[model samples]
Target: MTQTPPTVAEAIRDAALRLAETSDTARLDAEVLMAHARGVTRSELLLRHMRDPAPKGFAALVARRAASEPVAYITGTQEFFGLPFAVGPGVLIPRGDSETLVEAALAAAPQARRVLDCGTGSGALLLAVLANRPQAQGLGIDRSPAALAMAAANARALGLDARAAMRLADWHAPGWSAGLGRFDLVLANPPYVEDAAELAPSVRAYEPAGALFSGPEGLDDYRVLVPQIAGLLEPGGTALVEIGHRQAGAVCAIGAAAGLSCVVHRDLGGRDRVVAFSVTNELAA
Candidate 1:
């Protein structure tokens, strides 16, 4: 005799338990994956399909998650600043804490018309800012072609392609910003994780290392990029750079040394998450 298939709720319940060993948000992950498999939003899954039969191939998705794959990667999408962005293996997944950087940038330069996003991975930062501040046009530079591809795709998907451009460039490259005109605002979420820092299995095993670790103390990127930021910004332009929670002092010092004044912005958790910078005489509020 054939066995009955699990209900959507039952499948998620079992998958959540299995994912618990590997993920902090196991239930949420299960629900998200279930929604993906069913081709519905999580809200739709809960409201309209909880009692529905388990989606075909959902067990495979759960298995992947239980083995530690990121839910965003599994679903090929991640949300940033209330916008959906296309993301995959080679691109860095946008983080919620990084939204603080977006908020700080807009707060400092509400009418910014020209924006630059250094190390734009999925174009989420530049695009989100431009989406909210409609007058702005943005240029996103990244060294990785794969990342640039995703950024470009995200731009097109969000109907910001005409206002957002993705370029292949590196922060460390000499004369990289020569043709790139000064911008009214700049944003960066550089790799600031220490080389030896411990990370969860999912991050260490799946995320791209080139986008995760900066140096022994994770100050290498800031050292090279802050001065560049100083050159990129217009006279009164502001920049918001994301930082690891404990990195406020170090990152702020780097900004200061580059002749840009700094202010620390804390995430909702009250952790130092972004450092806003501006030319010394024109510090961002």
Candidate 2:
């Protein structure tokens, strides 16, 4: 006899079990992937659709997750600062930790009329800031055409295109920041993962390596950025840089050497996640 197909709830339970070996948040992964497959929000699925028949191709999604693909990549979207951004293969998925950078920027320069975001994957940082500071005009630069395209598209989708623009430029390239002029605020969440640091299979295999790994100590990009920050900022402008929790001391040192003082900010988890910089004083973090 043919077995009955699983209901949405049953399918999620089984998918969670199948994914448990590969994912720490397997149940959450299953629910999110299923909600996407069903074209509903996870909350909607939980509140109203659990007993409904599973959507077609849910098993396929589960299989992808079972192989360790990121849920955001499969859904082609991720939320940052309450804004939905399109993300996939070449784009770095926006993380919550980076929100700390946004909050710090907003608090530091609420009237920032000009903003710049380096390595602005998907335009989440620049655009999210513009979304809040409506008077701000923002520019996001990236070396990858794919990332620039995604950032541009996200800007348009969010109706921030008028104020947010994407450019193809590498911060590490000589004279990369030229013609960009100065901004009232600058943001960067550059690659900070040490070359030898261990990462999950999903990240190593799928995420863009250019956006994840820095040199030996993961200070490569910071070395480039912190020095130029003073020039990028309008005299009193502020620069907010995201850092790996452990890199605060080292990153603050880099800022100090550049004659820029730093103020460290902690994420909800109380880990150092962002540092505010200005050329006025010694490192304070």
Candidate 3:
């Protein structure tokens, strides 16, 4: 005899319980995965859970979670800076901490006519900044073609493609920085996780390591990025960067060494997460 499938309520509860056992995301992971499989929102799924059965696909999603895949990877999208962007294995998932970087960018870019986002990832920062500055045009640069494609899709989805462009160029690649030219604003949330060996299992085991750590101290990206940015920004232009909480002091010094007057910005958690700076000489002029 065939067994009966569980109702949506039963499935969600079971998934939540199982996910809670293996991941810190817990109930949220369960809800997001179930909603993705059912082609519904988390709230919509919960509202009808009592009346609905777990779709077959949703059961499979639960199985995947049991094996430890990130729910955002399963859902193919994530919300960041009040916007939804496409995401999956190749692209780094957007994180709320990065919003501090976006907010800093917007505040500094109020009068920006041209902006640039380095290491665009899923294009989260670039798109979020463009949404706030209708008069500003922006370019997003990434080393990965796949990442650029996702960024472009996000821009088009938000009806901001006319003002945003994407390109594939490694920040460390020779001649890459020179070709991009000057901008009134620059933003980057480069990898700054200092202790890769001590990362949470959910992160070290699942998220892309290349997107999480840079150099031994996790300060290599900043070291390479700040000096290049100094020459790239137009006079008086600002740059916003996301850095690790503990490494804010070192990151700021690197920016200062590169000629930027830096100020570290803290996240809602009161941890230093972003740093904003501009060329001191220009401001002094």
Q: Which candidate achieves the best lDDT against the true structure?
A: 2
| Candidate 3 global TM-score | 0.94
Instruction: Report the C-alpha lDDT of model 3 over 166-199, residue by residue, as the tens digit.
Output: 9888878778976677899999888887754597
**What ranges in model 2 sit over 4 Å off?**
281-285
Off by over 4 Å in 3: 1-3, 282-285
Check candidate 2 and list the clashing pairs.
none
lDDT against true structure, model 3: 0.84
lDDT string for model 1 (103-136, tens) is 8888899889999999999999999999999999
Worst 10 residues of 2 by lDDT: 276-285
Backbone-clash count (model 1): 0
Model 3 residue 200 lDDT score: 60
Worst 10 residues of 1 by lDDT: 276-285
TM-score of each: 0.97, 0.97, 0.94
Could you report the Cα RMSD, in angstroms, for every candidate shown? Answer: 1.9, 2.2, 1.8
Candidate 2 residue-wise lDDT, 1-285, digit = tens: 987778999999999999999999999999999999999999999999999999889999999999999999999999899999999998899999899999999999999999999999889999989999999999999999999999999999999999998888887789998899999999999999999999999999999999999999999999987898998988788999999999999999998888898899999999999989887743322
After the best TM-score superposition of candidate 3, give how far the Cα of residue 123 lies from its true spot, in angstroms. 0.4
Name every residue pair that clashes in candidate 1: none
